[model samples]
Target: MSADLVLDGLDKRFPGSPTPALRGFSLTVAAGTCTAVLGPSGSGKSTLLRVIAGLEEPDAGEVRIDGTDVAGVAAEHRGVGMVFQRSLLFPHLTILDNVAFSDRVSGMNRRAARSRAGEYLEMVQLQGFGDRRVGELSGGQEQRVAIARALAAEPAVLLLDEPFSALDPALRSDMHDLLDSVRQAVSPTIVLVTHDRDEAARASDRIALLEHGVLLHEGTVLDAYRRPQNVRASQIMGGRNAVPGVVRDGSHHSALGAVPVPLDTPTGSGTLVIRQEDVAVLDGGVGPADTGSIAGVVESVRVTGARSEIAVRCGDALLHAEAPPTQRCQLGDRIRLMLPTTAVHIVAD
Candidate 1:
């Protein structure tokens, strides 16, 4: 029921766009693995999904499902299930019928299709609302029905195009949990297209990062978080602190001071990437200074929700650190900043 999906040298150029939407983009997703294609608005995230779903033919390159080239194949015959950002359920159909539409179209008997639809409705936790009209259910409920409809067909590949982008924050979180549960029950190879990092990270096993129509990086969630391949990929995953530096011996010498980093890094000028969460802040009253300690003055403090973020000034550069909202540091206060060696990444430019 699940199949491996492969895209090889995919290139799609529209009539008047300045650049191709996808240029030599290639990725191999293992059977039943859920992967998210993450990028900005014009990065072709949805186009990549459309190509895989057979909605658009690639100008050059191929899409293969389970080792069979599906190029030029019809969307219906490709055995791919898709759920768009909008639910798009049939207006005239009842909630039960909307969930069962795929099965009926696939030629299952009326009774059998409704039976299976009821099972899927239960899977999406809408067991009792099957007979309600589509207009009667809420937006979240309709989206759930859309997902249930997609799963009822048992397609080899499932493509979700920002399925939760239209929902409120709380509803989006709930939909994410529901999607995970559905994937567990139906185990289809899934490609989730989303620009939201938290949504992508929550819904996917692996992440394929795209930018400007190119494949930037592809790896497990942990691998991406710990070691992104380049400066662009690192920034996409929230690696915001990039201080100019030079590679010296086997370390990087920056305004923040010299620190050991990857030596096989790019030559000449480069950047030292670090995340806010990785930067450590220590109160001067806590401990005596060591060799690696750096002194800085808190430039600003912002407390939002349960977390507080502060900017620290060291030399001519500024670094950010996050802490509990109860943290007592104020503007102009002196503090110590330490970046764990493991958290530092060198990217030559």
Candidate 2:
């Protein structure tokens, strides 16, 4: 049966450090869903994972798995499977023995453990490779074996800690696909910790951004991208082109120009976040008036496969725009650009 997981007011503080690794962080995962924890390094992503897996005890908080408090349970008794970045398989043991280690610890006979391990190996699509040494497999293959070993235990929840970091880019994408397939087949509640934005966008049904041990925002991918909670969240979510602006008269007036933005809050001064794709190119040497388009010259153009990204200089601000690959424009070409009214988000102070 699938079970939901909850973290209620979790906090952790290392000795001799003024700041806590985690501070009243709380999250809930619906059964059979994947929740990705994303943050910069030292943001306590790994600490939170360890706390959930019973490796670290929070100074003052509780962890509940499937509606039961697992605070007092030992790591092995918690029935939480963890796959780490490094495949810590025994070098001398065959892949089969590595997968069966947990079964043996659970009092299964050697023959039974071997049989169970065989089934798990097949599940990870490495059936015949069970007899091979762990050192003999490629990076991706070894990772698959690690996943098989973790799944062989049949834990209630699975925790992944940047498990595909060692693989190459192409192989990493393939592993992501394999992870989706496995999740759908098993329907297990998964909590993945990662620093890769693309990986979080690709694998997670819901994404949570953590900063300095605090959860800044958590929601659907589009929700986070569309409506970031603060300037930090907006920048971390990859809206790099931010402009200082003032919201008045149902529009935001910034260095670029005026754009329609919701003025719900009391606006003295705020930041306007614009996605690169939302900016369109205009051909002209003349600039638009106030409440008009911003004028800039193409500083550089980058051809990235299907689309071409253009960098424009509006006074001192660098505005990024994406255009069709077929549209060819040379450097030093002056152009007027507009930010989509729907895409411009006013970041509250």
- Checking candidate 1 for backbone clashes, the offending pairs are none
Which one is best on lDDT?
1
lDDT of 2 by residue, 1-57 (tens): 357889999999999998999999999988888889988999999999999999999
Could you tally the backbone clashes for each prediction? 0, 0
Q: Lowest summed lDDT over 10 consecutive residues: which window, candidate 2?
A: 283-292
Q: Residue-wise lDDT of candidate 1 within 165-210, one digit each (tens)?
A: 9899999999989988987888889999999988888889999999
TM-score result, candidate 2:
0.90
Instruction: Estimate TM-scores for all models.
Output: 0.94, 0.90
